[model samples]
Target: MNTKSLTLRWNKRHWVLLTSLLLVLCLVMPQWASAHAYVVKASPEENELLVTAPQRLTLEFNESLQTAFYNIKITDPDGNQADDGNVQIDPQRPHILETGLRSGLGDGTYTVSWKAVSADGHPISGAYVFHIGEPSGSPAGLKDLASGSGAAGGPLKWIVSFTDWIQYLGLSVMLGILAFLLLRIAPASLQREPMDVPGSYKLLWISYGAASFAALVSLPLNTLYESGVDLNQFSWALIGSALKLTSFGQIWMLQMLIALLIAVTLLSGYDLDRTIRVRIWSSYGTLLLVLGWLLTHAMTGHPAAAEQRVLAVTMNFVHLVAAAFWIGALTAMAVCLPLLTNRLPAKVRGEIYWVTLRRFMAWGMGAVAVLVATGIYGSLVILPAPVLTSLFTTAYGLVLIGKIALLVVMLVFAGYHTKRAKAATGERLSRSLKAELAAGAIILALAAILTHLSPGQPASAGPYQGTETTEDGSVITLQVSPNVTGENQFEVSIKRADGSVVKDLEQVTLSLTHLDMDMGIYEITIPKNETGIYKADDYISMPGNWSIKVHALTRSLDALDAEFSIKAAKP
Candidate 1:
């Protein structure tokens, strides 16, 4: 065949192989789905007008939330705080968050603002308006500062994500070293001894130090993300308040304690003597500390918020352990093997190399088995059937897909290394292990993003909609999504009676009312986008029929009105 013909054939073959791999991945990655927490319903619904003051304000979510991190504040129209300033999760319902109101709420408008970290460790929040007896002047709205969602923007977002990535990478390295020592090296050699590989123990110590520092630095970055505070404005006071008020702070506090414990234990050096009982005790204690460290992650993340929480948390813990064994073994071998081989006599070096590789390969195979099983289980618990089918449709799913792809590549390198390990002595084995570690680092990055990204768009009941013609022969259309009872987006489009799209308008205001239920008017200023569509987002809080009136102003006043309804229903 000619050169060009051969090149074309090769390209076609490459595409065919790539397509087959992706197809197999899709078939195997069915359960790698996840979701974010959102408000399902709230009492004293948004814009509700009450004859008697409410004794308490209650907010409910679709999934269980961390109580330690939730916040609710009520401010009366006069700008005075009306809540008791204490938020608690109801003992009867884990998903419900309640705060007591002051003894009496006089007439006027009151704003309820709330923030909570979802089961998946993502933060979400919103504000709603309610009236006592009669409506007063418009109250200022509270901004929702949920992390990794609508709350964070631009460089701030990248900062938070980067910090988290560092923490995760540090954790994987630390755990990997300890697990390698305790399971593979210590048990495999003579008398279940701690491997006396030079510089290996010191590498383990350094990994702990780096992980602890990353965890400490992450605490404040986490606070900034949760509180939506500007980087220039960060202060110790804000960090303190975060610890006092939110669940993220509390979980981070536990993580700090674990980090400090690990640090202290490492500082108190163990004897090099393998036969000493003290060495065994030190190893066991370090293992326990690392296990506790893993808890801080499991409790603060999606598994902790699962309905079958014990199962969820346990499965995730196992997944982390298995991952540590695989990644840590690769890391330990890569960093320590070269130094070890350089120091040993030629004959002993070759023997130790083959032995270590064989032992780690056997353990790694078991770790991979556990990882596959636990990963599937955790994904099923986090995502539903429909979401599973749309695994490639979301950012979270795509990241997950990337991780799986990298994992496949890592496995290929590992299998190649395993086959050559028995016969290959020095450079070739080292190169293969290094490639495996490189693949693992990419997988870690993808996993970090997956932890932060929302699994999919929150499932909604669909948009509440309305349309009306103005007195000036213009038409206005309004629509709201997942309009069931919580936060909803309001979108409006305008057109002339002549059937042409209305391109420009000075300002547009939307007011919604439910007079049958005595809910007072809640108004919002909708910004007109370049597309000439007006849009705004707010919480509806209650379930019932609603009346929407839109006012457009240019050189003249053009008014249009429509009706939409929201109902209480199952998701």
Candidate 2:
């Protein structure tokens, strides 16, 4: 049993994997509409031409957004800051984001650029162009506005992805190795005379260092990424806002606190092989702390946004624990095996090795079972009805396919190890162990990327439509896209009963009032363009019955007010 044969080191090949992961992060991100928070509706819609400068700019996302880091701005044709620098969102209606514009500016084409974190903590950003009076601007000008706005893509995304990988690796190794030491190594060493203070503890200490450092850096990195602030803009003020204003900030705090406790628990004389009582306390204590830490991680991602949050979070936590207990423990065991070959004799070491392997296999199988069950449930959570067919079509699905292939390779290697358990000191056994660990590394890498990607969502429903026939034999119809409780696209089309477009109207207004409550009336003068269609982006604000009134003023000063009713849906 040569120790050198069992060793694995970071060489050029591994660095290539890191580079590949970063490339994956950059290349597959553009088409990510179902990701964290994407623009569902923008006032003065994409590529729209406005008759006049809008007083304010508004954006509506499919989900609630974090206000602390909300960055929405309008830049003029010359790349001037045209927005009033006030991003506003009601705590009760975060989906409807609004920001005021600087008053009365001559605009050619204006770029509306925005960056925001979703409720789930994923950062999202994009830019769109709309013109006032006419369309006049180069793509380069809009690109300049997008760049000057400090959106959080580029190198920052790669850094964030790398940090995520390190965090997952460190936590899994730290906990999984500690569990293996107490549950497997300690029992055997206790049976014999007290063994030498081994290098396994040293390995555990290194893992703790990685995990603690990752926990510390993750907070600020998250703040920067979410706030769309670059390195030059980094400050304690930004970090403070994240901590104070959002649920994500609170979860980050909890994760940091748990990391500290885990460090203290390790340094405060709690050794795995100390005694039966110490082992029991250390095992149970560490397990609880790790669960608390993982629970906070679960609280930050897709679960927080899920309808069945408690259940989704619980399943995510369970999935992580099982993965640590199995794949992570295997990685720990492989690394420790080399050190063991140097310390213990052939007969005694072989007995302990085989015993530990046999014992772990039983528990590991249970962990595997749990992993299978939760993996299925997680997929279900990611892709629900109407989009379940995307299981083989999405980027998330491609990552899933990669994970399944790697997992099958790992299980095959594990079975080989089981068959060779009695004579596991050979180079074949060492090769098998390395193969299994290599598979783990790739799977974990994919898993890190998978977490950042969108869990598939159902395709959005179409707009609500209605038509009214005026007494003068004219027809007016209105359509509202995905008419949920947030911002809605209200479109009006008018024509004669003979199907000729109406040209008699001087001005048209759509007045909306909540029928259930006297919340006041909202009258927006929907602008009509050359296409003969009128459009206005406005907030529905709440659920239930609503009144829609179309007031059209004739060129001769006559007015026609047609009333219609609609039911608005919840967000």
| Best prediction by lDDT | 2
Model 1 TM: 0.65
Which tens-of-lDDT digit does each residue in 265-303 have in candidate 2?
A: 665434544775665565556657876876676676676
**Which ranges in model 2 have alpha carbons more than 4 Å from their true place?**
1-34, 49-53, 76-81, 105-108, 137-140, 143-152, 184-197, 246-248, 269-279, 337-345, 348-351, 383-393, 422-428, 455-571
Give candidates' CA RMSD values in order: 10.0, 12.8
- Among all candidates shown, the one with the greatest TM-score: 2
Worst 10 residues of 1 by lDDT: 143-152
Instruction: For candidate 1, write residues 473-506 as lDDT tens digits.
Output: 7777888776644456778888889988776676
Q: In angstroms, how far off is 548's CA in candidate 2?
A: 31
lDDT of 2: 0.66
